[model samples]
Target: MENNKNIIPEKSGSKYDLLLKIEDIIKKEYSNTEGIVISKDGEMIYEKYFGESNENQKTHIASVTKSILSILIGIAIDKGFMEDENQKVMDFFKEYDFIDKNEIRDKITIKDLLTMTVPYTFEEYMEPLEDFTRSEDWIRYALESIDGNGEKGKFKYSTMSAHLLSAILTKASGMSAKEFANKYLFKPMDMEEINHNDTKEFSFDTLFGEKIEGWANDPMGISAGGFGLKLSTRDMAKIGELYLNNGEYKGKRIVSEEWIDKTLKENQNGYGYMWYLIYNAPIRMYCALGDGGNMICVIPDLNTVIAMTSSFMMNAKDRIGFVAEYILPALSN
Candidate 1:
């Protein structure tokens, strides 16, 4: 983590006034927001903290973790660790008895997981934490959920389906998802690993009266790919900037430009490989969104990246509005 200094020099007049107004909207209407940082042309331009957080503080980022996982998959492909995204998911888990002799389940591929087209009904995999803990094998449990007999490419967003990608990464690369991220993505970008501080905002109470970092792992110890990642707003911004820079950070290619292009390409439902796209008039954006309003947005036309951390669910539209209504209008062409 970098120093919590306000690196961007404050601009005078209307820009400053508009920033104050944006902060007010975050503090009042968006009751769950912790902080937001906006960067343009790869430099911090506007940043502010609210409630009990600071610029460097890390918190649970909910489903934004999926976007990070997708990045890792990209890196895995770039390094030749995994040859292609079309590799069959069942090929990685041949030992699992659940998929044994099951052709339909075996047909699931890495692209399916990336595109959120896992065959299982969404509700079937919504297993509670207690039940998940008691399950002996998470990979087998996830594989057995291939009940979607309808259209093969139908989009069905499933957190459990995303979680399987983490497990597959571990199997394909011989390292945990966290290890792969640290070595490839985090270390190169100068981001830290899971902050182990017990009192941090992302900690949660356990049945044993102990606290664990916001990261939730499956029974197999693979990090959950869909959600449960804790990252500071600044760290999250680096991710957006990395994509905005087309997979290069500081002249180092973290992921291939081709992968970045495919990720931003419009797919089903205006989504592309876990990234969401929006076209609002003159402003078009690609975003990494998590539950509870956490977002890391990239606006290529303006060359801007925005990251926000929020405390409540169902507040993404409002946060995105701040960008459309306030930030974009202030930017110079």
Candidate 2:
């Protein structure tokens, strides 16, 4: 069982036995990876953990939270919280633009934020991330950061800019993003309850808690959209499962099939809504990838969902290779 790491096995096959051989390789190679969960044809066939981690432990999941936020955005649309993804960003936050000083901000749509094509004042996405997260009013902070620069449709990615979406969701739903997520997304999917981070200020420890479940928020109580979500390895798989089932969980529709079809299709960039679409892989799939090896991959053709998490590190994108090189080929056989 590879040092007692394999946590669950609902079913198995020759491919699973083959996949098990690579477990030791993954453990020795990706030393920081905390957990891995794989499911095929709707049954969880394998679950494992490493380095003092387990199935219930919630990793920070970093920017993978962006993809989950995208699902919540779809749910918001399905429930009629906002007219559509094409709605203007400024329409929800008149307080941020009372003077109407930024004409470009008025034209920024939710789609621009999802695709990360919205214009920004900073050249590097990290430039404003810390300052934006620490601000007393982050929604307004994110709003003021948008600039015309005449690059609205150009794909300039920013974690801080994505908070605009959480703020928009807050305004549209008349509840905090966490509340909306709990009511519509998490609960419906049977995921563990998610609570707000106690402090308005961000903390790494809150995310690393073995049992403490939390989602971060700005001082204004808007949930962080670009980052700051703590999810268990299996719960992340549940998300992939939800998408693989076309936005239904346990036969109940959570997000529309239309939303699922729209969000999974490759866009102009490699992004599908907030998901990173991968066509070069052994299978055509999409991923919610985060820093240091966190991922939720949905391979529709294979009817597979894979979820994983790791301690904070730099080789985060390597999880994609874990799929392309190992998981998909094993499944194909």
Candidate 3:
């Protein structure tokens, strides 16, 4: 998108051939793929659209939104909106009376939310999405539904836990996660030009001119940090680029390198914060993996970022392996 044809192609080599092969796999192996975008050293070297999707068309990124929220949490801490990663989450939502408040729940910290290890026993216990729309307070519902008996610091993929992080971001930053992200993360990365409606401060109710800016909110108007964020293939590449540069995008420091460093260390399940780590041979990949095969993979040692979006839901492991199985071996030794 944005007339990116000017991106000079890399030299014709094995890696370039391997880059081209990714599309064939997407088409033959994964028919649901929308597209794949790859960049190296900050320049988009390969991009191809499949089906009806274009380079700029946006779609729901599902759990990939969690990785973006993770970045914003690092920024919130850097800006002092949040005290630190260890801050107790209950401190932010003191207004709510949890149904099963216990020692474990009180010890739930920001880091726990970032790592998906919040001490809650309701793994598959969210009120139905249809029911969420009718509820007056999502955070209250989330807090009340928890059993508070989960093992602390253990990894459990919980969207409600992520929702708590979103609420904390809203309470600490005095704005919705969408507004705070646009102000700090997206706007700085030149999404203003990508969307052309970033001049005015977007109200929490709407952002990017209310024109499908790819954000979903709860009944209480807080952006869902765990899922339902929409971003184009191009926008996803920009986010990977930011992490590739260690929290600095295009020479401007957005979040601290300390935060990036902390994110690289595995917390659980080869996951650091919200980012998942997948080992692909000699390369250790840091990935923002979403339901339905949506992914933004960063190979720090290789200085490469690969992003892909697909229609299938909850199928990311095989897609990630494709990159390792094919792309990683093609690079020169």
Candidate 4:
């Protein structure tokens, strides 16, 4: 299938010194964590890297790509490529016929997919990653797996399911997801240059090792929605900053403020267009968290944004723990 917090008390010290101590924690404990960037009030407060990683290297962010895709979906609506998230997901999949008419897959809307609440069968949610990734057509396989009866509103997270959003983007925009993202999202934010290649390289052997240009695509050239996005840790913070500033970058508006606001409004599942918006916590924040501790997090109460990247190592220490237990209280006024 597809991939993919607590708070701490206040502490005393210079904010910079406290962050330096946090870096020490990362060095000793979370050895695989590549980098961490923190910005407060649109200013870079701290940025540090560990191991062989540096500011220039772009690491695969796994499910952090889902949050980026959510931004693109909002842009699609903002620019009139699509109307709204309520639009039927089947609107974009007209070319493909349904595998089983008994299922309510067509009734599934874009919001359902965005919130990970699509009523997918247990098998679809738990399908082996190798099996799903090796399929001839990923989007088709995911659609065929949908067996939503009345279970539409319940959370059913799956990577293949999220990839369908990418497919929808391609069909709606007539451009590959990478092309659209590069033109609309990355360029506006002055993101790192994406090295574009159309060649198909779908081997797990090269998945984490190979540094992809721009974003990874399936055989059909559609960008992966749930994973396969590689971005610099600082560039990931730019995304958080963008949302923190209500979807505008620099002086121009990249995405509508309304879309950004709507994207942060959580459903009962605590999800807001692929973002995990935590309203009940002492530090009200939302995060685009991914495997191996990759994340883009926004703390609205503090007017802060944080981004982090780590190697694809199992047993990586928790990014949330670092933020809650040390970073937040360290930065507290």
Candidate models: Cα lDDT each: 0.75, 0.80, 0.74, 0.80
Which window of ten consecutive residues has the lowest lDDT sum in model 4?
1-10
- What is the overall TM-score of model 4 with all chains considered together? 0.91
- 97-215: candidate 2 lDDT, tens digit per residue: 35547678889899889888878888844556657656677777777777755577888887865688988888888987788889998888888878655544354544333332587
Per-candidate TM equals 0.87, 0.91, 0.86, 0.91
Clashing pairs in 3: 214-230, 292-312, 292-314
lDDT of 4 by residue, 213-316 (tens): 55777777788778887899989999999989998888789999998888888567788888888766568899999888998989987999999998787767
Q: Which of the two candidates, 1 or 4, achieves a greater lDDT against the reference?
A: 4
Give the residue spans of candidate 1 off by over 4 A: 1-10, 99-101, 123-134, 195-214, 280-282, 312-317
Model 3 weakest 10-residue run by lDDT: 193-202
Error of 1 at 37 (Å): 0.7
lDDT of 2: 0.80
lDDT, candidate 3, 1-333, per-residue tens:
222232336567666776666666766777767777888877787877777788767866778889988998999999998789999878987876655547777777889888876655454444354444345776876665555666777676777777888889999989888888889988888873223222122332332122335576776678876776778888888889988998898789999999998987864478888899875356778999887788899998889898887764434456677777776775543
Model 4 regions more than 4 Å off: 1-13, 123-127, 208-213
Worst 10 residues of 1 by lDDT: 201-210
Pitting candidate 1 against candidate 3, the one with the higher TM-score is 1
